[model samples]
Target chain A: MVDLILGWTGVVLVFIGVFFLFLGALGIFRLPDLFNRLQAGTKATTLGVVSTTIGVGLIAKGWLVFSLALAIFLLMTNPISSHALGRASYRAGVKPYKGTNPDLYAEKVKKESDQK
Target chain B: MRIEIPQFIWIAWFVIVSIATILATIRAIVGPTNSDRAVGLDTWTTITTGFWVILALYFFQYILLSVSMVYAILSFLGVLAIARYLERGL
Candidate 1:
């Protein structure tokens, strides 16, 4: 009975992960610009992985340590990478979206704000 | 503690992640500029890390977890490398 329950839970968790992954991909493809695409890709993928990993760990039994470590690693590093990508893209002179509400660059705020 | 998840579920998980990777690939391909592609690639790498963990689960092997750190480090260093390159180019 316990095995049955664990197995069923695993199936559910796996499905959830897949759903989130599909959402991430959809966001990546649908978003208009690099910034938004990056946002979609990182956030959704991280969450999806968390769900999938936990599910797998529980189903496999005694992998709790590995899953916990993986979750921590992903949560920490994914954001840092996202930040780096954003900074690098900005430095590379990629233009912001035309519909942007504020033009910090136009106000000479780019450098000063960056320094802060 | 009895758990017996079907193997097919793991396979399904793999399929979904692969699809995500493919979608990321599309962004990388249609990226309007170098930076756009770089960001796309970064996102792609981040997803790939999770992929490794899933692979480990599917195979039910503890040793594979050891390799996960490598992916983590690569994703970390890859971004920093891009940052340095972009800064120097500016």
Candidate 2:
């Protein structure tokens, strides 16, 4: 009974994760600009993969600890990598989409360059 | 008798993830700028990590879990390298 319960719970979680993974891919394919794509891809996939890993752990019973560790690692690194990519792209002069307001990062970059 | 997860569940997972992979690849190939390609690559790697976990469960292989973990670390480092290269021109 317990095993059946865990199995069904895991199945539901895995399905949810897979759905989000597909959504992230769709966003990457359809989004207008690099920043928008990064925003969509990073946030969605981070949640998707983490959930999937944990679900896999639950299904396998003995493998839960390892899966948990992988989920935690993903949660830590995905955002940092996305942030680095965004900053690098901005610094490299990838223009934001037209009508993007504020442009605060560009101003900050300009100020830093002036200081140096 | 030992109950098992239905076989169709695995099939469904394979189909969905494959589609996701293809979509990401298309973006990577067609992206206008290097950063766009990097974003595609990043999404692809994350999706693949989830795929690997699913594969491990499907095969009931404990060792594959470790392999996926290592893959995750390597992909993270690779993305950081790409970002650095893009920023400064390596």
Candidate 3:
């Protein structure tokens, strides 16, 4: 009974993860600009991978330790990489979507350049 | 001992993820700018990590779990390096 419950729970979690993964891909493909794509790609894929890894861990009882560790490592590193990428892209002069109105990062960059 | 997941369920999972992978690849190939390509690559790596985990479960291979973990670490480092290279100089 316990095994049966865990298996079903894992299946459900895996389904959720795959759905988010699909969304991330769709966003990466269909989004208008670099920053928009990065936003969609990073957030959705991070959640998707975390869920998928943990679900796999639950399904395979013996592999739980390593899967959990992978999931944790991904959760920590995915954001840092995405942040670095976004900063780099902006610095490299890839403009955001035209709808982006805040323009705060550009302002901050301008101030820093002026200070220098 | 492998848990008995239905075969159709496995097929469905694989098919969806495969489609997602293809879409991301298309973005990477035809992206308008370098940063757009980088975003596509980033998404692709992440999806591949998840796919590796699913494959490990499907094959019931404990060793593949380790392989996926290593892949995750390497991909993370690769993405970071790419980002740094894009920022100024390598």
Candidate 4:
């Protein structure tokens, strides 16, 4: 009984994971600029990876420990890396897509520089 | 009796992941800026990690799970290094 339940749950979770990944990839393609693409890729792909790990854990019961470790590492690094990439890109002068709001970061940096 | 649902689901997931990989590859190739390519590569790495997990489950090998974990760490560092380089040197 437990095996059957776990088997089905695993199947569903894997499907959801794959679909989320597909959506992330789609977002990378459809979004207009670098920041938007980074946002989409980081958020969606992180969730997809965690879901897939958990699903694989359920399917392969003995490997749950490693699966959980993979999920934890992914949760830890995905956002930090995305932030680093976005910050680097911003500092490197990749402008936001046209018609965006005032550059608050730029203004703040300028003010800091002036004060210094 | 063994059910075949797991096999079917794995096959379906493989198909979806393949499509996603192709999409990421396109983004990486066509990216106008370095950051765009970095984002695409990061997405590709995460997807590949999931693929490794699925393959581990399919093959009933526990070691490959740790392999994916290590892969994730290295990929994270690679992106971080690229980000730092882009920020400081470019």
Model 2 chain A weakest 10-residue run by lDDT: A2-11
lDDT of 4 by residue, A1-116 (tens): 78778867877888899899999999998999998999899989999989999988887666667788789989999999999999888877788899678668888656755895
Better of 3 and 4 by lDDT: 3
Report how far off residue B40 is in candidate 3 (Å): 0.5
Stretches > 4 Å off in candidate 2: B1-3
After superposition, the stretches of candidate 3 with alpha carbons farther than 4 Å from their true spots are A114-116
On DockQ, the candidate that comes out on top is: 3
Say which docking band candidate 3 falls in: high
DockQ of candidate 1, scored on C-alphas against the true complex (2 decimals): 0.61
Q: Write the per-residue lDDT of candidate 3 for residues B1-90, one digit (tens) a residue.
A: 547998999999999899999999999999988888888888999999999999999888989988888888888898889889988758
For model 1, the superposed segments whose C-alpha errors exceed 4 Å read: A105-109, A112-116
What would the per-residue lDDT of candidate 2 be over residues A1-116, giving only the tens digit for each residue?
A: 88778877888889989989999999999988889999999988998999899888888878888899999999999999999899999988899999799887888988977997
Residue B68 local lDDT, model 4 = 92
Better of 1 and 4 by lDDT: 4
Clash totals, every prediction: 2, 0, 0, 0
Give the DockQ (2 decimals) of all models: 0.61, 0.76, 0.85, 0.70
Give the candidate order by descending TM-score: 2, 3, 4, 1
* Chain B structural similarity (TM-score) per candidate: 0.86, 0.93, 0.93, 0.89
> Model 1, range B1-90, lDDT digits (tens) per residue?
535556776677778888888887888898888777777677677667767777886676877766876787887887768866875542
